[model samples]
Target: MDVRISKRRTTGQMSVFELDALREAFRRSVRENNVTEVQWAEHAERFVKSMIRKESRGIQA
Candidate 1:
């Protein structure tokens, strides 16, 4: 699957409240998938690495 993320930059830091909300949403992702936190983190790591590799290949081409 090809997952594309836009390279848009946003200025300013998220407020504490917004940060907490994001945290809650992240936690919910794991809970909804019934995966342990460690497992979810590992999945994210692999996905990020794969994306990097794909980008590198494109650059080389």
Candidate 2:
């Protein structure tokens, strides 16, 4: 599947509470799925490339 992320910039940092929540979610995902950082990064790279290819073909995301 193709994934597209917005290029707009946000001004503020995440609150500590929000950061903790995200960290916990990530930990749970990793623990449950046995995912490594490298695998996650590679998957993200492939997803972006797919999105770019689809975009070049004039396909709406």
Candidate 3:
């Protein structure tokens, strides 16, 4: 946890928001067994993108 380390996502790695999406997807999978792969993927994508958007909006000089 060094301040100098870059926060940017590395290639082939998941971001914190994406990881959270996975966690949510897993839970939804268990609860909604009928969910399709396409639907699940969209959910994860939306979750991560929305969180990133929200986080970026909070940044200020």
Question: Which candidate tops lDDT?
Answer: 3
lDDT string for model 1 (3-56, tens) is: 222221123345678567756756666577687766987855654576558756
Ranking by TM-score: 1, 2, 3
Candidate 3 lDDT over residue span 1-61, tens digit each: 4332235433346668877876886667546666566577776576668766875685431
Model 3 whole-model lDDT (C-alpha atoms): 0.62
Highest TM-score model number: 1
Cα misplacement distance, residue 32 of candidate 2 (Å): 1.2
Candidate 2, residues 1-61, lDDT tens digits: the string is 3222222113334567856775676566666767778787765465457645865586352
Worst lDDT 10-window in candidate 2: 1-10
Selected candidate, larger lDDT, 1 vs 3: 3
Q: Report, for every candidate in turn, its global Cα lDDT versus the true structure.
A: 0.59, 0.57, 0.62
lDDT-sorted candidate list, best first: 3, 1, 2
Q: How many clashes would you count in candidate 1? A: 0
**Model 1 lDDT, residue 32, Cα:** 76
Per-model TM-score on C-alpha atoms: 0.46, 0.41, 0.40
